[model samples]
Target: MKYQVGQRITGVINKITDLGIFVTLPKNKFGLIHHKDFGANWLHERQNYHSGQAIRVVVIHNYRGKISLSKMRVNDSQLIDQTNDFLETKKENFLSVLAETVSNSQTEIKKLEQELVIYAT
Candidate 1:
């Protein structure tokens, strides 16, 4: 679906960085919620967000294949399971598994690189 300006999208929190929060949208797209878009004192307010969290945001800009998002009009229920303990636990478990997978991938990549060096020698 073509996301138009002013459209509201439901996406998953992919990652959080100093630059801003990255949201994973459908159709293999990622949207950016810049710090300025968060609101006043985003630097401090950022603490309230985390990876794997589902959030509702408005599409403020879409240019050059980059989608910019804002939480200006987002309602108080930022999360579908904001008060669900089971979902919170599931999120934690999913993150833990994802982290472990990344660690294992890194180790495998290092081994492959070392093998390549041996082959080159």
Candidate 2:
């Protein structure tokens, strides 16, 4: 069967190597799930993946009869959540810095105003 990009497919793991895992798709086509496409949990225990193990992966690229699979999408929800949390923290940090800068500017302006008043007296 011809697989297109962004298609979700299930395949059996045929071989596992240090670089990637080869999965046998329908119609004798083989797909590769690169090490980088896997999550930290899977990366740490590479041996857990063995021949004949079934897995669901997303097709990332299909070109010249070669297909690439990505398990990253399986954890996409968690990644998005983490990203949002990080952005929120950064925004809070920026706001704090801005508030401090404004306070310091106000203090300097008050000192200048007192100096001007004394000079006028």
Candidate 3:
């Protein structure tokens, strides 16, 4: 149901295969998490993902009518502070980039406006 990349959703395990696990999402939507994405220890991880189990996953890809999901990003580590720092750094970097883009766009617009005034006169 109206899935987008990077969105976190909860679904039930519909089936599991050697390649990946299929989840039943809301409104009959479906998603798959490839074996490699299950982490470095996939075989062992299989025990944790079973049929009828409810799981939370992030939408990694939603293209060409298929939705790829992942549980890796939801995983936390013992180094909670490091994880928080990393996320904060990413968010700050994104905001900085956006701000720089807006500033540059404004400067360009002002130049264009000046050129238009010259042409009008």
Candidate 4:
């Protein structure tokens, strides 16, 4: 299967070298997760990602059918910033909708109270 950049995939660690870790994806396709891809938290025990270990990675590049994967996103900071922006916008929208609903309910309640007063008189 053709792998595209930014694709998230699950694979087994097939080999480990000083430069990087190699993973075997479905269809026996292989890709390299370079040493630079390891997050700061994992740098200490980099050798621990042994063969047969299952890992989830995102494809960072595909050139001439050779695929490169990243254990951490190549653009993790940008991705996190964008995600935070989207969540903030979503929260604002939810609050606005909730406020509108509450306003409408209050208006309806006032109308009901007026009708009840008219009926009582």
| Candidate 1 residue runs with Cα over 4 Å from true position | 75-121
What ordering of candidates by lDDT runs from best to worst? 3, 1, 4, 2
TM-score of each: 0.57, 0.56, 0.59, 0.57
Error of 2 at 87 (Å): 31
Local distance difference test, each candidate? 0.79, 0.77, 0.80, 0.78
The deviation in Å at residue 48 for candidate 1 is 0.5
Misplaced by over 4 Å in model 2 are 39-43, 74-121
Model 2 agreement with the true structure over 60-110: per-residue lDDT tens digits: 788998899876674444323222223455665987877887999999999
**Candidate number that wins on lDDT, 1 or 3:** 3
Worst 10 residues of 3 by lDDT: 77-86
How much does each candidate deviate from the true structure in C-alpha RMSD? Answer: 10.9, 20.1, 13.3, 14.2
lDDT of 3 by residue, 3-108 (tens): 7666667899999999899999998999898999866799999888789999988777789869898888655342132223234556649878778879999999
Candidate 2 TM-score, true structure as reference: 0.56
Q: Which ranking of candidates, highest TM-score first?
A: 3, 1, 4, 2
lDDT (10s digit) by residue, model 1, range 20-66: 99999888888999987766788887899999999888777788879
Number of clashing residue pairs in every model?
0, 0, 0, 0
**Highest lDDT model number:** 3
